[model samples]
Target chain A: MRVYHFSEQPYHGAWEADAPSLRVTLPNKHCDPKVAADLINWRLDEWQLCDELGLNIACNEHHSSATCLSASVNMPIAMMAGRTQRARIMASGYAIAQRPDPIRLAEEIAYIDVATRGRLDVGFVKGAPYEISPTNANPVKITERFWDANDLILKALTHQDGPFSWESEWYHFRQVNIWPRPYQQPRPSVFVTGGSPGTAKSSGANGHGFINILSGWNARTLFDMHRLASLEAGHGVTPWSKFVYTALMGVGETREEGHRRLMDIAGYFRTTSKVGEAFMNPPGYMDVAGNVRWLKANQTRGRAGNHFQAAKRDGEKLAIGSGVGTGLGVSAQDMADAAIAFCGTPDDVYEQMTEFISHAGGVGNFVIMAQGGEMPHHEACANLELFSKEVLPRLEEFDQSQIHADTEERVLSQRDEG
Target chain B: MQTATMTVDHVGIDVVRAGSGRPLVFLHSVGGVDRDGAFLQGLADRGSLTAPWHPGFGHSELPGEYRSVGDLALFYLDFLEQEGFEEVVLVGVSFGAWLAAEIAVRDAHRLAKLVMISPVGIKVGDRETRDIEDVFAMSQDELTEAAYAEPERRKRDYSTMSDEDLTALARSRESYAFFGWQPYMHNPTLRRWLHRIKQPVLVIGGTDDGLLRSGYLEGFVESLPNARLSRIANAGHYPEVEQPQAVLDLIDSFLEEE
Candidate 1:
């Protein structure tokens, strides 16, 4: 497994339980520029440490929020490209739907890929529902827009023959010719992250990597959908490398200490749920069926009133049950039981990971949120150091190729018999 | 009252019709419409009421190609032509009013008069401020409060509703978002074309409308060549629902004017 160290780069100092929200509604006056600068510099230093420690690096973007400082994902990737040498850098990812200019994004990614010397894995995401209003993007037809943008960006990156004219429902370009073409021949390895089967199917059909982040039991189902879609598209069974899983991770000298550290890191979830109900589920963000399900659930829970009451009710859920897939668990045991987090001594953490991998069929990339919430810089560095030294070698030794080959054989035999 | 599926341009449109006289087309707001509602009866009393649920609102089949208020307005124009209506009186509420304005702007020759109730289609505020409250952004209860002078009077118990009712509710929400999400509720360039509508217009607004500011109703009157403004007390966005008699009185007087 190729384990990638990731952090949301959260500004934990701004987290206040009484605050209306930590996201879109939170005013900029709460954000201290000097402290933000220090935090950004510290996080950068930690990413540099990952390079020396033999761990791959991953970056993600969020906007108009104190939860994540990385509003523009490209800036960090470009910054890391010049600093890190061997580690494969990934953005999981840029919000394609909200971005108005795909051609400009194409140029920026191309420059980053060239700078990284072809060591880049590009990831495109649909962004958070709460960000719809903040980005001033239409929530309707967002998925359609995302696909078009994705196609346009790829075309821009690969078409080196000459300028091309492109026009679609959501975007229009008179001429598309991006300079500094990607260093990778065909294009850089692409990854897409989402929680829905439709998204997984699209990712697979497009022959792109799929990342399932803390989706719990549903992660395997989403991966299988991706595999089936790829096969149906006549692309052959997708390899283990095409599937990635993300979770909060922590390690320490003892099992109890590791659990404690991970619990601390999981504080990220506590702050994340502070979003107001008004922005929780914007219309058209979720599909019709999904909205119906959510509405029914809320009504059943007697939380289907005004915004404040609904937000409070959801906050209660976040403290307990809703944390199953997300890292909002009240206890270390809750997180570990859900398999959305791995924490303990090297041996314990390794065993938990292998168990999860077995349950998931196979996952080649493990995206680890090493630093989250109020984790001090020194603590984050120590966690990374221990994980790299003790667990990385064992994880590298575990081969997915044999497992995948066996599964393929079993499937073929079953098909023949049927 | 009768609900029939009328095919226009190969698309199914659910039209509710009642009474008979000079054709009065009733366009509903984002909340869809109640075919059996008392307000619709008041409209029937006024003239031959022909209320068709906008495509994608209720049982109407939403054409994939139709994306904006302009498209819906054009479809409505076709509906009027297909039905062979003359001296048409166009009456619309809320989002439907926006459609009516667009229709009048396009072609006012067939329309004798226009009535817009609690309309939201034009931007009257500065760049940073929005003229209409974002229905998608607010909570259901918040929206209820904004849409009704007495919020409790408009409360709906979805749990008690039938499966079809619930599905219709969800579909209406989805359709509303699809049409109004971008550029919000107003067409930025629409204000420029208001002069094209020469038909006498009566713009009705709720005095207590939380969705619209005071000046928004006045702005519509000022833009139209032959138009006037009236307000209904004890009502919010849907004046006809809260104070039907008052709104109907104003409509009756306007229609009777020589």
Candidate 2:
């Protein structure tokens, strides 16, 4: 499996003049396009560094709050065009349906693809309720918008000369001729965010990739659902390459250290619940009615609010959380040990990652969460260095042979069965 | 009546007292309010008004140590208790509204009636939430266009302002660091604690607010036990500026009711 390092630059420091940090905090709203640009540059620099270190792709997300400065994924895609040639620029997603003109999105993607020389992995999303409000698009229609926009973007980017007319409940367009076609012939590889059965089905039917933000354990079920969807959609046992991608944070000197780091990140989210919620859950963005309806409908499912929350809880309980705190839950070493979970001696992390990868069905691309919460720059750089030295080389070697064999076997078996 | 320009915790907070009645405290929003700022004027025109600069806004000495919204809330609570305002009405607008909600949750008995206008704490679904990061990216013209309804009113040249006035605005934005440094302009659990507010709350939101939608007001009303909602038409996020009379009327109606 190809390991792609994902760095989310969460700019952390005191908001006041007295606060000290490498980056200066400009006096502006978090959602301003300029701040988004600055953050994109910072993250791209990190990504470029990772590419130099032999990582596959650099990743970031679009969100309104503190967790992410890039509210619109398009900005990063545009910015990363000239930065790096080798590493794929992954816009984890832009809430495609949220924009008024999907055609404009098509044009932008085409422009970026041409500029980047075919190194773009586009992630389409329906967007969380919080991020959706800024677009002024109806929340309920977001799913429909995503599908329509995806179809249009794909058609516009791939098809050469013909009037492309689309008639849908939400969108209506005729004679769509997108200028400056993408560098990749069939358009850049498409990846959809979310782990729902519906998303899996859409990914499979469309012959795109599926990215699951869930924990490793729940990821199995997601992959299973994707496969089932592919089978149902007549794809018939497709290779894992076109199926599943998992995003996670890794750090370790030993197995224990890796677990501790994951826990610390989780703990940061847990203790700073208000901060996370404030950053993640902006007002008038998500479908409050839908969320309330879903909660009421699935109240029997216990405390799980939605799929995202469910995955987080499951991931935290199984690996993410357990890695941070020890059995007793209250100990200085335990808290201190948490840092080691995400930041440790390199060899130990490789082992922890290998075990996670194996359990996670040997994921195609392991998107490493390089930045989160208030993790310092030096710490992030240190983690990256250790990961490169200790873990990446081993993974690269294993992937070269393991992935090739797995693909060959799977393909041969499918052909024989057919 | 006594007026003192004392520094509390190195924060030059102004204290205003009038009449032998119940103590009412007011926390102004971003820009410093003069006698014309209806909310401050209305309260002072009615009863005792203890209007403080909130460390970074008005004539107050900006505290070097303050950071994070919780710190501001805690400081205000301490400010009230220190000033011997046993029972008080806490009125906050915009950022101050969030502070008011937080204060009520933290210590409800100290507050009599909590008033928040265009308060932002909970995530309101389907409204255009202003991206603080994005706002910072704009030029002064763009900032004014985004922030105020009357863009013409914003001074073309801030350079012309007196050193003190300029410093105050800068300091206010800097103090904004305490409340809005990280995660932009929100405290996640503040919404969770809305239910904890025992005191009556009057939430006023602009009907035409592009930033925050009407549903936010409804959510606020639903969340708080003794909360009422009032919508101001033709008003943006800052209704106190856009529809001052309507806001004052709502406050009057809310306070007059049993």
Candidate 3:
């Protein structure tokens, strides 16, 4: 398994501000440019460390939000490609649906592919719900828009003959041609992030890799759905390597030290859930049936309410559907139990990761969020150095064939249930 | 009021009608007007009244091609032409009023008069100013307080509602967001064509509509050639529901004017 080092490059200095939300509505006046510069540089240094450690690097984008300072996914990828020599860079990824100009995005991707010397792994996401207001994007049928944008982007990347006109329900281009087509022949491997079975199945059917972030047990069903859909679409058996799972990880000399260090990084989950309820689920972000289910759960079982509040309450395990490592009161034990965070000494973290991969029926690429929230730069570097020295090398020795029988059985059982 | 499905332009629309005479078509707001509700009943008692759920609002079929309020206006015009209605008195509430204005501007030969209650269709303020509150950006409690004169009367307890009721409400909210999310609630250029709606219009505003800016109704009336502004007491965005009898009496008087 290949491990990718990741960070949200958060502006945690604003985490203490008296704002109703950390996203969208939160004014940027609270953000200090000098602090942001330092945070950006710190994360870049961490990505460079990954290069020396023989680990891959990943970055994601968000807008009008203090949670993630990387507003443009391409800028970081471009910078890292120039700065790091060996790390395979991935964007987890650009919100293709929210971006109005798919051609420009395609051009940038091509530029990055060439710059990275064919090391770019492109990922397309349907955007977060809070982004609806910032982007002024219509939430209804946004998934359809995502697929349409994906089609345009891929066509723009590979169509090298000449200028071409393209028109779709959401996008229109009079003359479409990207210069210096991708360095990778045809295209780089495409990945998509999704939490729903429908989205997973569609991703598989489209023959793209699937990435699930902190979804916990529900990720199994999502992965299974992707595998089954791929098989049904006549894509043959998809290797376990096509699936990726992202989680937070911290390593220290002692168990207590690791747990304490990780609790600081877990601030990402706490502050993210601090968003105003208005922006949490915009109308039409989910379909009528999905909204109804959410409403029912929210009203009756109190399941769909804010994780921030739930974590504040003493001793309530975060309701299902929550990404692991979420909420303010989540402990190190809770995170390890949920498989959202693997923290401890090198041996402990390695054991936890191996067990998680085995239980997941095998995840080929494990994206580790090494730094987030208020984690100090030195602490982050130390954590990475320890992980690289012990756990990462051992993890490389794991072979997927060992779990092939169990994964096949699980897939068949899931298919039979379906 | 009688409820039925009307298939227009190869799509189904949930329609409610009552009484009989010169057709008085009533277009509903975001939450949808009930067939047995006091507003429709009051309109029905006055004349033949027809209120149809805007596409995607309730049980209506929303054609994928339909994106904006303009598409809805066009569909309504086709429906009126197909139904062969004449001298129709068109009335609309909130979002529906936006559609009514669009339709009148496009073609008002079939429409004898127009009534717009808490209408939101035109840009009444400068670029930096917002004439209508961003309902999508407000919490449920905030929206409720903005939408009602007496917020408690309109506050909903979802636990008590049936699945079917919640589903319909969810669908209406989704449709509302789809139509009014971008460029907000007003069509930027609708103000330019208000003069094209030659039919006399009665622009109604509620005394307590927190959703609209102070002079929004007056500004809407000023853009028209023959339109007047009126206000219903103790009401908010949905004056037709909050003070149905007063709104009905105002419409009754306006329609009777020679």
Candidate 4:
């Protein structure tokens, strides 16, 4: 398996106990920049360590929220690309919908790929509902803007050594030209991440590398559907290497320590997350059924609600329909039940990850977000060390060689039948 | 009243046409078809009235090309010209008023007179001017509560609505976001072009609307050439629906002022 290290880069500093939320209401003065500056440097150093330890590193951009300090992933990713030598720097990635200029973004990504000497993977996400106010985006056009920018950016990137022009419902440019093309020929691999069937169909039909954040029957079903769509494109099928399975992971020297690490992730969630439905997801971001569920969750919210639904907040409600990340309130037990998170000794974590991979129908890229919430920098670093030493080696047995052979055999048999 | 399908630019729209005097075109607000209440029938009593659901709102097919309020304005102008309606007495309400103003500024030769009701266009102030509310962010109940003098009078409960009504409302909200999402509600540069509308105009609105403040009505009236203001008592955005007789009287008086 192609192992990668991922982190949302939480601030991990103290704030008001009952601040309502980590986003809009939380005062900016509460952010200790001196502490944050050190934290940012420390986080980068951790990524550098991961690179030295022989692993890929993935970082994401989030805005207007204290849950993640990565307001802009490009600058940090570019800086990290300059610092690291071996590890592939992937951004799970920039919110294309929030960006007004796709061409500027294209040039930035192209330059980063060059800086990395061809070790860049560009991934795009639709974004959280809270990203609306910061981006000055109309929540109604979020999906439209995302796809519009996606189409324009791809065409700009892979324009056959081009100076291309783009005109669409969202944007109109007279000329599209970039000074430096991508380091990787024909551009680096492009992937779009989403958890819904609609997103799955789109990513599959477009032949994009589909990375699922969840692993289970839903993931297996998504993979199968994607494979079928790719095949229907006459582009064969999505290669096993193109599928990424990302999960929250925590590991320690002892079982109790691992459990504490897991709960720390949950504790970080309970204190920081606000359970407001409209703030998390405004209207038009979801479908009719999604709105229904959003309403249902909003109705059931408060002290007397189910511990599972109330603790995790409405952030996880997005995950219920689409396969994005889990809500912070997700306990170690909840994570284990869904097989979306692992926290234990090396062997126990290894077994859990292997089982997750099996349920995913075998994926090539496996990203573990071991650092999140209030997990101390040293603690996060230690968890990574345990994971690298114990879990990383055992993952060698879960590669796609067998799946590739099986796929080849199936294609040949189908050809014979035809 | 008669209702039927009208095709414009290869897209089908449910159209309501009534009365048989002079042709007076009525462009509706973003509230969509259900806003076709007693006031509309009153307007039809005086003249030939033609009202179509805005494309993608209330049973109207969503054509991909109908992306902006500007597009809608251009389409209505084209419809009037194609149908050979001369000296059109045009009436626009809320979102539709913005469309009417767009058409008038671009080309006003065909319009004899124009009336705008609580229009949402022309940015008057950057900081002091209150913004149009984020209607798409609101629930159906919230929308109804803010839109009418008495929310219960409209009976716009989501639970009571038919599947068709609910779907149409959802689509209308989508259309609202598509047209007015970025600029919020008012057009940034439209204030400068208000002088281009040469037709005699009447700017009318309700006194008490949660969505619209007094500044919007004042700003709109002050910017226009050959314009006058008429306010309805104890009404919100849909003054015509809330106080139909008062609004009807104002329209009748405007028409008589030849």
lDDT of 1 by residue, B1-258 (tens): 888878988889788889878889999987777777888898898789999988887768889788899999899888888988889999999899999999989877789999999888898889988789877666678888998999997877665666666566667777887888878888998889999999899999988899997688898999999999998999898988889889999999999997
Worst 10 residues of 2 chain A by lDDT: A298-307
Q: Report the TM-score of candidate 4, chain B only.
A: 0.92
Instruction: Write candidate 3's Cα lDDT for B31-99 as tens digits.
Output: 786887898898888888888888898878889998899999999999999989999999998899999
For residue A395, what is the lDDT in candidate 2?
A: 73
Flag regions of model 1 displaced more than 4 Å: A297-329, A410-418
- Stretches of candidate 3 above 4 Å error? A297-316, A319-328, A409-418
Q: List the residue pairs that clash in candidate 3.
A: none
Q: Candidate 3 chain B — worst ten consecutive residues by lDDT sum? A: B155-164
- The TM-score, computed over Cα atoms with residue i paired to residue i, of candidate 1 is 0.94
The true-versus-predicted C-alpha distance at residue A214 of model 1, in Å, is 0.2
Candidate 3 lands at a TM-score of 0.95
Model 1 lDDT per residue over A1-418, tens place: 7889999899877876346667777888888999999999999999999999999899988877787999888888889999999999989988999989999999998998888889888899987777777668887778899999999999999998889989788888888999999999889988898777888999999999998777765677787778777777777777888888988898999988888789778877666656656776776777766666665544411121121111121223223322212434357755666666888898988988887787777889999999987898999999999999999999999977777876555544544555
Among all windows of ten consecutive residues in candidate 2 chain B, which has the lowest summed lDDT? B130-139
lDDT of 3 by residue, A214-329 (tens): 76655666787888888778784456788888888988999988887788788777666556667778777777777787776553212222532122113345533243234655
Which has the higher lDDT value, candidate number 1 or candidate number 4?
1
Q: A353 in model 4: Cα distance from truth in Å? A: 1.2
TM-scores across all candidates?
Answer: 0.94, 0.52, 0.95, 0.88
* Winner by lDDT: 3
Cα shift from native, residue B55, model 2 (Å): 54
